[model samples]
Target: MMGTKLQVAVIGGGAAGLCAARHLLSRGDRFAPPVVYEVSDSVGGTWIYTDSVGTDRHGLPVHSSMYRNLRTNLPKEVMAFPGFPFGPHLPSFIHHSDVRRYLEEYAQHYGIGEHIKLFTEYPLPISSSSTRSRSRTLKEEDQKSYHPEEVAIKSFTYIIIRNRHYSDPYIPNVPGMEYFQGQVMHSHEYRTPESFTGKRVVLLGAGPSGIDIALELSQVAQEVILSHSRPPIASPLPGNVIQAPGVDRLSEASVLFQDGTERRADAFILCTGYNYSFPFLAEEVGLKVEGGVVSPLYKYVVHTRFTSLCFIGLCKAVCPFPHFNCQVLFSLAVLDGSCPLPPERELNAATAEELRARLESGFPARHFHKLDSLQWDYNNELAQLGRFEPLSPILKELYENCKAIRGRDLINYKSYNYKISSGSSREWSLLCPQ
Candidate 1:
């Protein structure tokens, strides 16, 4: 086993999965080229917008949650992968289709497309409910599930799994929902604003999707009501939009708010975001999905209890491409025995301690994987451990500035262009979008 090239199984062909495969292919001596299992017929997982929602042609739940008019909220400068620029000509906030093309190009350029097995279903977790407390021993059946009839059963020490983190959109069940129902749907089902024309819409979340969807609906809807538990947004909403307190309940032909206010609406759109569901991985692996967070993962990549398994691209509110790059390289270093992890007991303790601290700080368990502003620190930690160059400081500065721009003007933020020059000075600028 030590003499032969290490075999790795990458579960998805999304951005994170592509990063893992690209890095593995680059290091042919230490690792074998990864076998990437993509459920879709192509790369670029969530970036690919499918007009078909609910279930796809294969009867699998539709993986993409992207809307028609969606452009990246983050600028291209921070979103580009390290060592691969998006080039100087493209606008900072490009459309999602452009992102899919860029990923396809990235795969083609690196010869990763040849190794990718598209239109394959993810293998069910080897461990079933019977083995509730212990990791499942991978048998010949598991290996066959990975490559189907093509690749033979081979002994591989490491398995790299990618979790896209954007499946199973969530909509909280409000009481009395059955009483007043016009059209109830989640943002994942949303394709265009045309269906909502001239209607009174109630959006039940103020996250990025809610804000973006409300803005899109404002153009076509007669009136849009944004109901949320949080305090009002700092930025002013459009004139046609109304901010309401959290929903208390609903009645026939009316909606009740916590403030005792009532409004009647034609449709209900839940932008409440998604849940963390890894249907492929069983519970015996010492991982738990309570609320929206997957737990007991050291560094949010490796399974602390099962060292051979690692998950990529699970963190939320991150600079995804660059974040995936760092996570992938660090994971490879761990697999190659270049970067040593802590003992199993220490790993479990560290994971628990991190969650304890976060909970003590008043953050919900659902946000355990949200990196948000803390992603810069997480990236540096990985780079230092993996012995790779850390991301430039300018990226963090520019990222924060982008958040500020969004807060100041959600509608006009995408209109600005951004650039981050290379070298020590690392000049950053924001110009008008072309």
Candidate 2:
């Protein structure tokens, strides 16, 4: 209510941070212009950081650079911003570059680029010796190691953005792999079908990427063998299902099957995805991973102990991340007193654990959160804090559409489902995931 300006620090200039900044600005009288710290020179986070290793049909960079066949899993309707609707000429499921362009346009349209301080890395703040000194002034002995930047100040509120890049491919130690005289590369390094032309390729993992890569290679490679310990759940999309005979392990440039069959390969593509790594908070933050499951916070946003700092864009179950980011911004605004703070106990431990367990149980254990369930939880908390509003008719209609096609309870929606559906089916499923 006072005229004093509130200083808010957003650590990451990616989609989540930009959204939060916009939300804070929207609350005209609540806070000052937010400070956004971006380590990269450009606006696109991972998209800008990763190099183009692949190309599209028009010779444009794919993935971030050149990722051919890389399409957004979400529908354009739900994925697009509220005001600046997606162009009608674009496909329902557009390529990744389109998404990047949209992000750039959103940033420019909202004037968020001005607030972002690019190329600034955020290290943990150091403790000040002055705060610990018994005397008002410290002697030269205490001043020897003291630095002004080391001091922790309480002037600004901080929010951390978290995301895992698909670059780090998981390569399990396989016997005789080192002896193999063939080319071996992780999915991150993979760019185009030209690299595997006329080569016998052994593709690993059964996830979406693996399946897609194998399908691509099958066209150019002399023969493509998909090696997996267990059968992959076929993507729900309609297509010719290719199942390579099961293989037990890789050995001497060849795949050895459980039943004693073997086939040589000229190249091996590891389509295994990334592991969740938080080098910044792995030690200082008490994150616990038991039986390959990690749960570091309540509702995957707020730390149970350190409530001042929150994590945005960490949910694996969500798609069209802007939706979840908006919810997070709303929550953050409530915390900042620009709006009302949600009740502390709306997201119960039991529910959070159940959600966590279900996500971590898949073959590749990708996390997925249901849109309606998350919105419900978010709205309930907002209601307790007196900041709740019913979903707009458009959002409500989208939610019902998503629920009807999935046939699963809205409380249990997951991201993997999006990967399975065809363009048309996916278009029909347009709810915002948490």
Candidate 3:
């Protein structure tokens, strides 16, 4: 009983969850096999593409925002988890199906798929008596499949929420939305660009998804107005696509641009991004999402009050799989007493100080978790704290270079091929100039 393995319940069998499970299995002496609860039948989280939108057959909202012809923006070299590289035969940037298959392969290679509890709901309210948390309602009768004893716990049960924030799409609020009602939709509902053929579409937000969707629609749409608050993208857009300032508001038949221009749009698609929703987290958890920032999370992984409660894949503008790996290791270290966390007050103060520093540096409160270039150091700190190997230096170099390439030509950036040399060379290169 003294050496009993810790029970870990991973909510969401996405890449992050799988990483958590893999590490948990790696340290069999410390951790029991993680029970990964995934709402979908598969393990690929948002990468699992579906043509269906709005709801699934079970009447649940569709979580995948993948559209047809979508490909990974990050090259497989950087996208892959450490020690597990994407196939050499595969291109640098690959199709969504390839990415899905990569995740499946990662799960299988680590025997993580066997530990996954598919279609299982998670994070029901934590029982006051025991540290064990009861799972909420399951969809249909899939609850019958999982053995409750597997998720049983005594002390704190580690909850690794590999939750995909992309599920909750966020459309910017503009005044007078009730007046001009075209086929207003979020990027989540976009499956194929064929329906927009011969239509005037005004897409909101200039993020990667917005620009990508606009480019796709240009293949069919007669006119595409890409609206955004960010500086005008210098890259050449398709003939049918044009750039405009952010939308001021909507009239009965037109949208007014911030620069005093107006356009009658047949469809308005919001690529504004999404809200981080953890519906499974009970109210007592004390975690809060305010203005797009999830708080009480020290260093973005460990919950200050609930030390065993950890989050993965929450930071944006990052190389996801490796980031998840670092976070998972750090979480396990905290739980296993390898990386002892600070006291509650110190933890909260650290979180507050980090936020305050970022805010003072001109980062918007809503974009506090947008790590971008800061992810390299964040990952390194996690590795240093958790006693795990940090990511290769070349990965960050490649990542930054790719961002520049994407900015130079978003339309053709995916055409490039890259290769990271094997072992401690810590070097990478562009394979071919496309």
Backbone N/Cα/C clashes per model: 0, 11, 0
Clashing pairs in 1: none
| True-structure RMSD for candidate 2 | 9.6
- List model 2 lDDT by residue over 1-434, tens digit each: 54575556666666677777777677557677776765445576544434445433323223232246566544565566555666766755567678778778878888888887654544344111111211111122332322122322334544545443343345677667787778988777666788778888887776546766776677677787776766544435223223455556677678776668888888877766665555435354565444334554555566544455566665543444545455665556545665533444544464466664666764333433333436544544534443545333344445445546444331233332222133533333333445
The digit string of per-residue lDDT tens for model 1 on 267-308 reads 988888888777777656667788776867889998777777
Q: Judged by lDDT against the true structure, how good is candidate 2?
A: 0.55
List all candidate RMSDs to the true structure. 4.6, 9.6, 2.9
Ranking by lDDT: 3, 1, 2
- Runs of candidate 2 with Cα error greater than 4 angstroms are 1-5, 49-69, 125-155, 165-167, 229-241, 245-247, 258-260, 289-292, 337-348, 351-434
Which lDDT tens digits does candidate 3 get at residues 306-374? 887888889999999988989998998998999998799999999899999999999999999899999
Best-fitting candidate, scored by TM-score: 3
Better of 2 and 3 by lDDT: 3
lDDT score, candidate 3, position 102? 89
Overall lDDT per candidate, in order of appearance: 0.82, 0.55, 0.84
lDDT of 2 at 276: 54
Alpha carbon deviation, residue 417, candidate 1 (Å): 0.7
